[model samples]
Target chain A: MDALLIDPVLARACGSALAVILLLGAWQKLRDMAVFEAAVELYRLLPDRMVPLFARALPMLEAAAGAALLLESTRGIGLVLALVVLGISTGGVLINLLRGHTDIDCGCGGADGNTRLSWALPVRNAVLMLLAVAGAQAGLARPLVWVDFITVAGGTLALLGIYAAGNQLLANHPRLMQLRNGS
Target chain B: MNEALMISNALLWVAVLAALIGLFALARQIGVLYERVAPMGALMIDTGPKVGEPAPSFELPTLTGNARVRIGGAADKSTLLFFLSPTCPVCKKLLPILRSVNETERSWLRVVLASDGEQPEHLAFYEKADLKPFPYLLSQDLGIGFHVGKLPYAVLMDEQGRITAKGLVNSREQLESLFTAKELGVASVQDFIDHQHDHQRA
Candidate 1:
């Protein structure tokens, strides 16, 4: 563990990127609570009665976790919360995929709400989980420097760009398949 | 040596950032291309009267007044038969679009609203939606004649009373695609796409 410890700059960069992604997702859900609620209902993992409660609470939890991750003091709790949220979502998607119900909306906020469930979603969640874990790991005891700031900012922005690009690819996958099938 | 290493690291990080930005822009362009190339007109269900066939005629009474509405016949202008229901949320969402189409295309088109339900409910919806400009009618025979199995279906008829285009339309773009299909002399947008593909291959 000691040998594997990352620099504080790297950990901070990961945490910042995850924080931005979580905050943006939470904002999209909150923008249209009704649409999110409908998406949750379509998942059918939760009972009809619990759908509204879960829908309302999930975004609040996401926003809270994102805020906590921004501060070093609360990052541990934020990491745990993010893992739980991602676990629940990935599990829901996996269950539906196993049942061969791939036509349902992903409910994950994207360029549009029409993204369908597919294998890529679970893989995306796994990548995000890995980021959360890396971000949560304790850093080596080293003094901060001016150059570290530039590296951290650059790293975080790069991570966010990769994430956005991945999401666009995922969103386009179904459309690409449809086009290919000539439907 | 430490100063030299730090400078190199900073330069490499900047380079990586630039590359990531380029990748992101490339991905966004791919998304735009998909949107442009995807055939996104109103979905045409093949159960209804075929395009270019004479539309089944109907002379139903308007919901609000005693005026009789003639659906299919030789008219001075083209007719747009929009099938809707008061209970359909999408249909309600499209009322404003239909009104705008009525206003803009009034010169060459006549928009008529059709539905089959209780008169009182439709009358209430008709009043609430402020659809006084278009002629609203209720006729089960018209719906049965068209074999409409979906809400928010539409049929476009030319002045010769021939079915120019028909489909299940959900958005303003889909609604306009009916006119586009007619103008292009294609049976449907899917047909148009296939035609384009054939031309490219040839």
Candidate 2:
């Protein structure tokens, strides 16, 4: 079952998709460090002493991991770091959800950082982590071909478009609920 | 027979690729809908007075001394009631912006600053912030009436005292969104965008 799921071609496509998403997220944090810091503060999961340092370092770490994921030699280390980072963020979202702090920004970037926490966020992270693990475990089955590259490109674009759509829907959920409740 | 099989395989790949493109297009359409429906302007909590309803009336003492001010229910000017605090850094930052907004539309708009805190601290804020141009009212009752749970909140009321728009405003853009919503006769910017999208589709 595991071997069936960890197909090398699928793994490469997942790696590319995950790298693009993480790189975009990291770039947004780097673009506006202050906004990212404010979002971290809202989570209230980090100590005051650690918040500034973590805020400064997290984007750099994500960007490095994303870049490394695209390279053949560093792909292993990149997968490990991607899993760790995705786990930490999933933990953050899960903690905030449990605490009933639903209004804070997810800091995921894009759509003006307006994306709020929802059940979808942690689920999305979990899905990415699974993809990262599959990519890390994938073994070469055969030589590459032009058709294989085309498949990877199409698959990655499809995955990313769906991901973007999901994030936007999560952001819209609260407003739609409000509109429904007539408040 | 072999050539026919190869042609069939190529056709299958083309069909799959077309299906992927169709799925992607559908996802992008949903994204556009989300973008139009979500409130990117201001973070509005659900506890507040509902937009389009009459604002809860309050007669509170103004900081300018001796004269009590009445809010809500049929006024000469539309009210831009802002809830702020002396301690909130964001609220303090917004004072100048609010002052300019007050100055620019002095005729049709009545910008009233409301807060619930110690009198002396507010007095100091009033003096140091140079908020003499606006009516700064110190009233917990007004804040409670509006169900303002956060600092730097704003509510726009029409001349008939109907709540046009209200939300937790952080930036000047968000503050301006309130006015924009009012001008467009929508409850919020999200609604305005959705309305426009529906019109376009129609």
Candidate 3:
């Protein structure tokens, strides 16, 4: 466990990345509440009466977790909140996938809100959960330096870029398969 | 030595960040290219009025106005009958594209909106969609005549009432391909590709 501790700078970078992702997810959901509500209804996990309420509350929770993650004092609670949210979402995806309801939208909004349900989504969520866990670990305290700031900023941006590229690839996967089958 | 190492580390971080940004941009471009190339052309269902055949003519009433709209006949400009519905989201999305096409192709093309629905519902949709410029026709016979099974289908008819090309179009590029098919003298882009392959094989 001691050997698994992340460097403070790297941990900060991870937290910041997760925070930005959560905030963006919340913003996307809030931007189109109706669409998000429809997606939640499609999940079939919540009762019809609860769908709208859950849909409305999820983004608020995500925003709260994301804001909490930004502050060092509240990062622990934020990580827990993020993990719970990710777990529930992944569970919903897993249930739907198992049910063979792959036609519904994933609702992981970005440029690719229309991406269908697939195994890749759970894997993506797992990766995010790993980031949350890694971000939760405390690292050895070290004196701050200007170079450290550059590394942290650069690292976070790179992580975000990689995340975006991965999402684009995920979005393209089904279309590529369709093309391959000559459909 | 410590100072020099820090400088090199910072420089390496900057380079990595630049490389990641470049990678992301390349990925985005690839995504766009996939979208552009995926739908080779509007999906030709093969059940509709065949290309190069004369379309069944219809004198339908405009939904918004009292004027009668002629669907197929000898005309100066080509007619593009865009079959759409008030409830179909994809059809709604294509309205803006249809509007732009109407504007750009005004010289040689007359775009008409077609659907089968009740008067009050369609009239409300027409007003809300701001479709006053294009003649909106509510005719079930028109849809059946064309064998349109999908929402947001398009049929392009030349001045002589011949359907030059027609198919299920979901995007702007797919819609434009109907015009391209007309220009190429091919039934559809799929036919154009098959022709190319045959030529190469020969």
Candidate 4:
């Protein structure tokens, strides 16, 4: 299972997908700083004063990590940062879940901000982290030529679209349940 | 031979990429269908009184002095038991909508507001919201009895005081759904959908 997970194509696809998601998340946080701040506040993880500071700093860090992931030289550092960031945030969600604070907004950036903290979120983060780890196992077996770039681009785009659709489905599940049950 | 192998590899990659994109597009279509099917409304938690059963009976004092209101019995009028909290923002937002519903359905429906909290705080909230139209009662026991884990919940009882529908209502649509469910003689939206499916099959 472990060897199958770290295939070169899968690694490249996961890396690009993670990078795209992080960049988009960073851009969204930059667009609406206050909303992101409020979302961070909802977590109740950081002290009240530090909430503002963390909210302001998180987007920049994500952007840096995203940029590094795209560059061959900085890929390792980027993967590490991605791991740390994803790990901490997943931990935050886990803490809230254990504490029974599932009603709080996840503050995951962009259209997903309204999503409440739940088990699915931490699991999503865990999957993303796994992708990042696979991506970290760099040094491809074959030397990449011009043709490889096309393959990577196509693979990345495909993965990103699928990831977005999956997230949407996750967000829609609760509403579906409510509708089914007859609110 | 080497050149041919390289060309085939490139073609294979392109084909795989195209296939993946097609899969993604199909997933998007499924998402659109999911959105059309699923809607936002109150959630019916599988706890407390089940539908078609007698609502737990209770006598609680009205917010006003020296008056007691009866809940869950063979009352001639159907009852809309709205559970709210003074501190709940959603509950506050739903108050006006509840009032309008009460006004429109006054002849056949009796809307009651139930909460579990300090009397003075509730009185303050009632005054602030100008809640003179509905009977407001304070009872923690009632909330516990109903197994209300969330705020802004509503329960509909038929004229015979049996629970027709109840769920954790968050929006006006959700609140209305309870009535719609009861009117259709279904326990929930899912039940209604299933019944329709069965009818179609028949």
Q: Each candidate's iRMS in angstroms?
A: 5.0, 6.5, 4.1, 5.9
Higher-ranked by TM-score: 1 or 3: 3
The segments of candidate 1 whose C-alpha lies over 4 angstroms from its true place after superposition are A1-5, B1-3, B40-202
What would the DockQ be for model 3? Answer: 0.20
DockQ of each: 0.19, 0.13, 0.20, 0.16
Better of 2 and 3 by lDDT: 3
- List, residue by residue over A25-53, the lDDT tens digit for candidate 3: 99999886766876786676888789889
> How accurately is candidate 4 docked according to DockQ?
0.16
Between prediction 1 and prediction 2, which has the larger DockQ? 1
| Quality class of the docking in candidate 2, CAPRI style | incorrect
Candidate closest to the true structure, highest lDDT: 1
Candidate 3 wrongly placed segments (more than 4 Å): A1-4, B40-202
Best by TM-score: 3
The global C-alpha lDDT for each of the candidates, from Candidate 1 onward, is 0.81, 0.77, 0.80, 0.76
Model 2 reproduces a share of the real contacts of 0.13
lDDT of 2 by residue, B90-180 (tens): 5755777888888777767899998876788689878866888788898767876787755678999999999999998988899988987
Q: How do the predictions measure up, each by TM-score?
A: 0.61, 0.60, 0.62, 0.53
Over B53-97, each residue of candidate 4 has an lDDT whose tens digit, in order, gives 999999888987668888998998999999987545457668879
Each model's number of backbone clashes? 0, 0, 0, 2
In angstroms, what RMSD does candidate 3 have relative to the true structure?
Answer: 12.2
